[model samples]
Target: MAQERRRRPARGHRRAAAPRPPEPGPVLELEVERIAHGGVAVARHEGRVVFVADAIPGERVAAQVVDAGRERFWRAETVSVLRASPDRREHAWPEASVDRAPEQRAGGAEFGHIAMTRQRELKAEVLRDALHRMGGVETGAAVEPVDPSLAPGVDPEAGTGWRTRVRLHVAPDGTVGPYAARSHTVVPVASLPLAVAGIQAVAPLTRKLEGAAAVDLVAPAEGAAQLIVRSAGDRRSSRGEPPTIIERVGVRRFTVDRDGFWQVHVGAAATLTSAVQDLVDPDRFDPAADNQDLYGGVGLLAAAVGDRFGANVRITTVEADARATEHAGANLADWVGARAVTARVDRYLDELVAAPDAATRGLTGATVVLDPPRSGAGRAVVDRIAALRPAQVVYVACDPVALARDVGLFRAHGYELEALRAFDLFPDTHHVEAVARLAAIV
Candidate 1:
C-alpha cells in the first residue's frame, strides 16, 4: 500500500539559489614600468602591482590576468602590445613569442623578445637595484658578455646557441618539450634556439617519448652531444654507466658526470674561471693556507686557483654530492695538495670552527671561494664563514637578490666589498652571474 501524496503546483517554481562566484576582471591595459627580478616586467593596474610576462619596460600592453588571488599583487602575461618598446625584437624562439597564448609559449628564454644589448642592460639594472635595495651598497657594476676569444667562432654576445645543457619535460601523454612558462605542462616546441648546435643535433624535439619524465641533453666541449632520457616515476636514466664526459675549459680537461651540475652556457665555466683569477690577488693568495672552494662542482673553480697559483696550490673543495666530489678529486689530481672532501658546506664549516688552534692556524690568511647556488650561502653559512675569519671571500652568485642579501650579511660581519663584476652568462634570461670579492676589514 502506497501513501497518497498531495500534487503541488510546480510550474516555474524555484527556491532561492546559491550566489555565483564573482567573475574574473577583464583583460588589463597596463603600462609596463620596469623590469623586476624573476624575468618579469612590473606594471600597475588600479594601484595594484602586476608582474607581467612577455613584456619590456617602457611598453604599454594589453595582458591577460593569469593569477588574481594575491591581495598585494597580481600576475599577467602580455597578449597584445599597445605601444612597443624600441628594444623589443622578434623573439629568438617563435614558440615562446607573445603571439601565442601565454600558457602555450615555451619557457627558458624569457628575454628573447628584447634586443641583446637591452637584455644585458636590464640585467644590469636588476643587479644594481638588488644591491642598492637589499645589500645597502651602491655600485655601478655593468653586466658584460663572455669573452668571444674563449669561445672561438661562436659569438657568445649574440646570446643564442650557447646552452650546452638543455632539459626538456615530458607530458603524461608522451609529448616532449620544454615546460610552458611558469608551468609544469609541457608545450611541444619545434626548436631550441638557445641550445648549442651539438645539443640541437641530438635533441629529439618532435619525438613522443613514452614513459619518460624528462630528457637531458649534454654537449660537452670536447665530445659529441649525449641524450639521457629519465623514465617516469623512478626518474632514473634509461642508459647504463651514468655516462661521463670530458669538458674542456681553456687548456685543462675536466671529467664531469653527464647528468651532474655544470654551467649550462658553453663559455660560462671559462668566463667564471677567468673572472675568479682576475679577482683573486696573487699577493693575497697563500698556497699553504687552508683555502677552500665551497659548492665546488667537479673542481672547476678549484682548478682556476691551481692554474693561477701553480700545481702545488693547497685547496680543499667541499661538496655535498659524493659523485661530484669524486670527480673533483680526479680533475684536481694534478695539484698534489688539493683535496676534495665530500661533505655539506655548513657541516664542513662547523668542523673547521670546532677544530683546535693548531688545526685552524692555516685559516688565518685563507681565501674562501664559494660558488653557492641561486639561494646564496644564506645567513648561517655566512656567519660560519665569518667565524673562520678568512682574509678574503670570493662569492659567485646567480640570483641578484640572494647575493645582495648575503652581501649585506657579510658587510655586517666587517667584510667590505672589494670588487664586483657581473657577467651576462645567461643572456636570454633574468639570471646574471656576479663574482664579488669581499675582504675582511682590518
Candidate 2:
C-alpha cells in the first residue's frame, strides 16, 4: 500500500497567505438577562443584546436565528436546550387539553422546552417590568397586582366562556383560526378555550364559517348566533351570503361589520363598563337612560350608568358609519338623554372645542372623556384638549406603550395621573386594558 498513498480530498485546506471572512451563524452561548414584553427571552451576547422566543432566564440553550436586523442584532426561538433551569421542570406533568398548539400533539414538538403557565408569568412580568424600567412607573405603585375577578356573570379559574368577540382569519380553504404570532399561518384550533362558553359551545357555527375570508364572531348578552364573513379574494358559503357584510351579535338581534371596531373579548364589555363607572359619578346620569346611551355599541359606559340617566343626560352617540350609528340610534332611540350623533370623533371634538361661539374655540373648565384609537392622542387632538383645558378627562387605553407615552405627554401638558387601573381582560395574552384619570392643573 505504500506504493500508492491516497491523496486527501483537500478539505479543511486553507490558502496560507489569504484570510477568510468570519462565518455568520447562530450563537447559542448568550446570557439571558430579562424577559421581553412578547415572551421573548432577552440576553446579552458579547457586547450585543439578543432576543430569543420560548427562552427562559439562566438557561443555556441553542437558538437558530430566524431574523437579523443589522450588525450585533438577531432574534431566535429556542432550538435545543443544553442545560435546564427551574422552569423547564415545572411541566413534568401537564394537563392535557385541546387548547394546545399543533406542535404539542402526540409526537408533535415545539414548546416541549417550556410550559404555558410560565409563559403567562413571563408575559405579565415583562409588562410590569417595562413600566418600571421604561416608564419610570414602579410595578408596586403603577400597578398593584390585583387578583382580578373576571367580569361578573361568567366562569372563572379556567377562564372559559369569557369571549364575546373574536377576529379569526380565514385561509384559502376558509379554515378559521387565529394568526400565529409574527406569522400568517393559521394555527388550527380544535376548540378555542378562551372564547365565552356560549361561543365554544357553537361548533356548528364555526364549521359553517369555514369559507369566510375572516369571521368576526360576536355574542352579546342577548341575541342570535350570527357570524360575519370576511373574504379577501374568493370566499364562498353554502348559505349564499356575501363575505363582507354585517350579520348579528348575540343571537342575530344586533349587527356589526368589518368597519366597526368592537371590543376584542366578550367579557370586556362588562370590564370596560366598570372602568368608566369608576370615573362617572352617578349624579351625572338619569333614570330614563333607555333612550340615553353612551354612544358606543351596547353603551358599555351607558349600561354601567344606566340607572342614573334621569337628569337630562342624552349624549350624542357619535360614530362615522351611518349603518352602525343607525343601528345604535335605533337601539337607543327611546332613551330621553341619549342621541346617536354620527360624525368623525376628531371633527366632533374639534367643533366641541370651538363651541359656545367661533371667536376663540377655546375650551375652559370642561369635562371630557377620550377613547381614541391606538394612535392615542395625536398632536392635533392633544393641542385642542390643551386649548380647551377640560376640568377632568377620563382616558381609556388598550395599549400600554401608547398609554404611557400619552400619559407622559399629558403630564408634560399639566395633567396628573390621579388614578390608574389595569385589567387582564385578555388573559394568556400580553395585551392589557387600562384607564387613566387625568385632571387639568389649572
Candidate 1, after superposition: displacement of residue 272 in Å?
A: 0.5
Ten consecutive residues with minimal summed lDDT in candidate 2? Answer: 1-10
Where does the lowest 10-residue lDDT sum fall in candidate 1? 1-10
Local error of candidate 2 at 404, Å? Answer: 1.0
Give each model's whole-structure lDDT: 0.84, 0.51
Q: Once model 2 is optimally superposed onto the true structure by TM-score, how far is the C-alpha of residue 51 displaced, in angstroms?
A: 2.4
Q: Using lDDT, give the best candidate's number.
A: 1
List model 2 lDDT by residue over 1-442, tens digit each. 0000111011121212322323445756656666765546787776767887655778876775656656877776555667666766322112112233322321111233444455445545655565555455554423222233535434443433556666566655656666554455554556665566656665333464544556656565555435655555532332553223333322223344333445655556556656766765343322332221212442334434432333354454555545556666555544566666666666766786667753353434334556655556556666666656655566776666666676666766787667677765555444556777777666
Best by TM-score: 1
Which stretches of model 2 miss by more than 4 angstroms? 1-30, 56-61, 80-160, 173-176, 203-212, 227-229, 234-259, 281-298, 302-310, 330-335, 356-365
- Would you give me the overall lDDT of model 1? 0.84
